[model samples]
Target: MSQNAAAATAGPVSPDDVAGLRAAVTGPVLDPADAAYAAECATYNLAQPTAPAVVVGATSAEDVAHAVTFATRHGLAVAVKNAGHQVVPSVGESSLLITTTRLTGVEVDESARTLRVGAGVRWHEALAAAAKAGLAPLAGSTPGVGVVGYTLGGGLSPLLGRAHGYAADHVRWIEVVTADGVIRTVTPDDEPELFWALLGGKGNFGVVTRIEFTAVELTAFYGGGLWFPGEDMAEVLEVWRTWAPALPETASTSFAVQRLPQDDALPAPLRGAFVLHVRFSHLGDAAEAEELLAPLRAAGTPVLDSIAPRPVPDIGAIHVDPVDPLPYVETGFGLREFSVETLAALVEAVGPGSDCPLVTVEVRALGGALDREPGTPNAVPSRGLPYVTFAFGVAAPPDLPFMDEHLAKYAAALSPWTDPRNVVNFIAPDEAVSEAEVRRLYGAERYHRLAAAKRRWDPDNVFRRNHNIRPSSAPAGD
Candidate 1:
């Protein structure tokens, strides 16, 4: 049996084990008793907690390998964290967490139109580097999110997705350290199965050290936010439902039903307000975008209009996601279609008079290139999904019942239109998905393929934390 298989009898992680890891790694290795352990494991979402027996702050791929090898020898499962936006709380699980916050690096090839980033690099860092090269990557809404983790979960760029497809679809290469503690450079041409699986399998396969992906040629785009009064939500949504579907591939849109806090940091109009925020990003000139946006703009007068021509780095302003760590309950899933019925259901669930405690209920239209297959196919299951919905409720662990009740109600309201496929990044940190649900999420064929790859690379399942994709030897459904 593998060392990981014999781990149950290995007892608790000892001080000597932590000391050995600290000596082997170039970065810090802290246990629960260490003074710096909590901060080392800090995540973007303060609500999601972790309790690793030992924390390995990996500075390089070699450090990651050493950590992984040590975890295997000690029979400890490995959990990885970088930006920690999608952290799955350790709770009762005993594992060694590898923190990749120290592996920051960025490089752009203007001639090749590709970018290389360390696993620790955030989207903002990469965006700035690519902006200097007159190019842009397919980054997600929050710039604070780590590039490697997001891309692995099929990075959906609010600005580029409709035209360019998912960030995973454009990936050219991946550098990962597998369960066996060997760092490998993976691509479609080399280690094809591992490449396909890692792009979507997440931490189940191994810890990705670095990645290289293609970037678009353009730098600037016409895009921004438009917030409307909460009372006029139905009216604005009706116009948007029809207007957004007719948009060209060059344009993308989504709307959020926000219950903003009365924070001093917020703008005057949005502070302590319930409003509908419509986000638009178009790869076109101002005149053309304005013409396309006429209907929604004319819908019951917007309270705030910040839409304009902005540089690639300013893309985060479109969603305006919180940068600091805060307690919140978040989850997302795909939608087969957002018909009139779906819109009505949404309005009834979180409209003006509703008592919904969720901070933001968002729906993004997905189609155009997003539905099509890229040159080299990947494991992204949401390809044909017409829409993707994300929602979050501001609440700490003690307030779980309050947040969870409304979240459940909101989900039930849209259950009729819910699709099984979802972006891995958008999954809830606390979600406990069944094996059958996971199979359905990826579809039987794809899940089987991923499981087979996991069997090959990590048969012992050393990396079982996060949204685990088990290295099952049986068939997909079995």
Candidate 2:
């Protein structure tokens, strides 16, 4: 073994050795003792905090490669963070965290109608940059989410997804630093399998430093969110269950049962309220969109309504996801279909008198382009799924028992419609961790192919932080 490898194996990395890493990289190499460590490791999801022995605040792709090289030499596992929206819980001291927040770059190719952004670029940033050129990327429900991570995990845009498919479907290329410390520009012609796995496989393949995707020609939309009293959930949802599925490819819809907080962040009408939020988006004339939305609108009284034609940048107005970190447990799974029975089940679980304890339970209608395949094939697992449900509850210590029980109950109640595979982005931190669970997520054939790619690109399983796809050569149970 080399000097560095032997030295690393003997014990924890010595101060002098860490110093060597700091000197090699063009970024801050922080340790727990460093005064800036805590701030550097903060996460958007307070429920799953990140704690790593070492953190590299990478400024560029070269810095990321250096950090990966440093971690591999020390036989340490690797984890990555950009916006820290979905941070993975660190295993222990043997892991190195690479924070890509410093690599904020956004470039719009007006002629080609494409967007290229650094890993740190959020959807809002991409949306703003693309708008200046009359194009748009498939940004998610929340504008604050990082573009790279969201697209890699098959980003589901609440406004445009049903019309244009997943964000992963439009990726033109990806710039990633693999476990071997190599910076590679992956494309369909040049690393097909790697490209396929990276798109829908989440973070299993490598740490993506930058990504580029074709943009849509959208400048505005005819939709926003509406909030109705919780008591009207059953009635509104009844109309939605049948109405949403029949929406044209130019339209998309979703609704959530929310027991909101009394925080100042929420609007006056929504603060400390129990309400049903109905979100809609249509790439069509305002009159036509309004005609399509008439049935659901007339079903119940809307306490807050903003469904109107707005600029594309206001796409986030459809969901209005929280802008601040809050302690919560999130889990989601796709549904084969949302039939009348499924609606009945949901009503039984969280309707008017159900006394559901969860803060949010959202069901988005999925069909149209979302149910179809992209031009080039990718590993996105949830294609063809008719609907997907995302549920989350607060995770305070005192609320653990009730929350856990209720969450399980909610999942069990919807099991009849549950498809084994899910949208990769919504898989919870504590979920799909086991090998069998991950296999079940991608299905046997797809997971095996993903495993083959994992074997080629990350045989040692260095990047096992997110919803890990183990290499086929590894022990089955791992």
Candidate 3:
């Protein structure tokens, strides 16, 4: 090993080492002792906190490359954080953290209907920019989520996902700083293999600086949520299971049983109550949207119905995801089919009177364009899976007796219908994903291919702080 590498392994990073990092990059380098360190390290899911030896507030692709090069020379792990929505607990004090929040930039090509967004740019920013051009990017439910990270995880958007597929599939180019300290502009034509790997590969290979992706020529959508009492969860789910599959490509739908806290911010009906929220987004006329949703509306009376024609910029309002960061435990699994048995199991697990401590249990219907393969193949796995079940529990100080037990029980109950695989995006922050689970998530063939690519792009495994795809020749380490 080099002298720097030996020194890095010998003991904790000294102030001089941090000073060297600061000198190497034209960005702020923060040590743990710095006053701003804690705020810079704060993540969206507070449950997976990280304490890196140094945090680099990256302002440009060059800064990212400098940080990666520094980490490589010092034999330190490198981790990238934008919005810090998806957490990987492996990034600890031994690693070098690069925060991309300073790299917020957005450029739109109206004629091509494309958007180029910086790593730190959130969905709402991109949406607003695209909306000016009468276009819409495939953004997920939450507007606060970082565009780059979300796209890397095969972003499942609310509005046009069933019609357009994942946001990763729409990507045209990616600007990344690889482990070798090289700034690469990845596309199908330029470094095709790396391009494919980076799409759904997460941050294992490099820190992405910017992404250029296709946007839809859409200005508005008729979509929103309908809230029913907790008592009607089973019936609502049954109706949704049937209704969602029958819906056309222009529509995407999901249902969630939300046990909302009694907060003043919440609507009067939803505050302090267990309610079932049915979210629907249609890319067609308002009248058609209403007509298509008639059956679900007829099934029961909703205490709150906000379904109406809305501008595309306001799409995030449909899901009503929390805007502020909070401590939460999330777990999810893909299902081959939402069978009658599976529906029953779901109701038993979190429906009324179950006393489930989970804040919300959601079932999203997947099919249509999401099932279809993209023109250019990428790393996104589990395309044909029909449904996904996700549950969120608040990470409160007073431990609930049923937290782990209920989660396991819920998974076991749906095991028969559940696919052994997982959608990478839905993987929880603190979830322990084993090698076997990785193989199950990505098929054996794809997993091996991803590993081969990892070997080529990040041979030393410097960027291992993610849903890692370990190089075939390298020993897997945390």
lDDT of 1 by residue, 1-478 (tens): 6555665356677787788788889999988778998898887777777888788899999999999988888777888997747575563336889989899989899999999999999998999999999999999999889999999888889999999999999999999999889999999999998988988777779999999999999889999999999999999899998899899999999999999999989999999999999999999999999999998888878899889999999999899988778888877888888889998999999997888979999999999998998898888888888888999888767996798899899999999999988877778865635677778888999999988988889887777776667776422211
What is the TM-score of candidate 3? 0.96
- How high is each candidate's TM-score? 0.97, 0.96, 0.96
Error (Å) of candidate 3 at residue 294 is 0.8
Please report the TM-score between candidate 1 and the true structure. 0.97
Over 4 Å off, model 1:
91-93, 473-478
Q: Relative to the true structure, how large is the alpha-carbon lDDT of every model? A: 0.87, 0.86, 0.84
Model 2 poorest ten-residue lDDT run = 1-10
- Model 3, which residues run further than 4 Å from truth? 1-12, 398-402
Tens digits of per-residue lDDT for model 3 on 36-141? 9998888876666789888899999999998988787666789988874656567787788999988988999999999999999998899999999999999999
Tell me how many clashing residue pairs each candidate has: 0, 0, 0
